[model samples]
Target: MSALGMQSSILVGGFQYWDSRRKGRQFPARGDLDPLIDIPRLVPHIILIDVRHDPLDFRFRLIGSAVRRNLARDYVGHWFSEFPNYSASSNIWPRHCAVAESGRPMLQRPTYVGPNKDFIYVENILLPLSVDNPGWSMQMMFLEFISKRH
Candidate 1:
């Protein structure tokens, strides 16, 4: 089983890639990943978030095409706090906070609450990305959608 105990091949693959990049460090630097050259097929489903502190907020550094299509908006360069329906008390925020603070991979299975309710849920792997400094990092998120029954 993968570190996150997930069975989805896509999630597993993403985890494997992130794990491989670690070398010996607890987390890999953002510069370590090149979506086009390394994970081309999974590129469209990836989202990169910039972690900010002194209040703790997240910014959309990069939103993949597939993710944008599903959300029906391109949120690149926007903060998560600016998104509609976003609340600090929301269930999603803590998951992110945990990963950011702990520098660990987290498996998230959140039901579809976006524009399209036809999807049953989404499988997401949030992997922490570190720089040279401590307490400063980004998050690499990989997602897969599951459709609801007819």
Candidate 2:
């Protein structure tokens, strides 16, 4: 396997272990993921969403600086649809929605086209979060770039 593929596998494995340990409970809320508090062994890019709203209403509640540099622009309050054509936003949106609705973790290995048509491999994890809200419409997504060498 390629280096990116290997790294992606490791990340997926880690997420799987974490998921298994959760034992069907919902992921913690945004405040629970505070930088000063939550320290992940692998510093992946984290994103939170509120599925109660429109899919187009999804936002990035958290993102690491390293991940931010690879993205086209700031995505703090923007929907996934706001991403440029190079970003493969459309392909990933549906999967994200499914993960939110099912309240399950979804892992994806997608080739993202960055600025100037540069290609980068990204391993993303969409973990469902069940807040006190009625419909279990909250979710937290974590993205870890395998590497930028490719």
Best by TM-score: 1
Q: In candidate 1, what are the lDDT values of residues 1-150, reduced to their tens digit?
A: 354678567788888899999989998998898878998888888999988875788888887777788885778998878865544678888888999889889998888777877888888899999866555679999888777863
Query: How far in Å is the alpha carbon of 74 misplaced in model 2?
Result: 0.3
Which candidate has the highest lDDT of all?
1
Give candidates' CA RMSD values in order: 2.0, 4.9
Q: Which residue pairs come into collision in candidate 1?
A: none
* C-alpha TM-score for every candidate: 0.90, 0.67
After the best TM-score superposition of candidate 2, give how far the Cα of residue 98 lies from its true spot, in angstroms. Answer: 0.9
Clashes of 2: 0
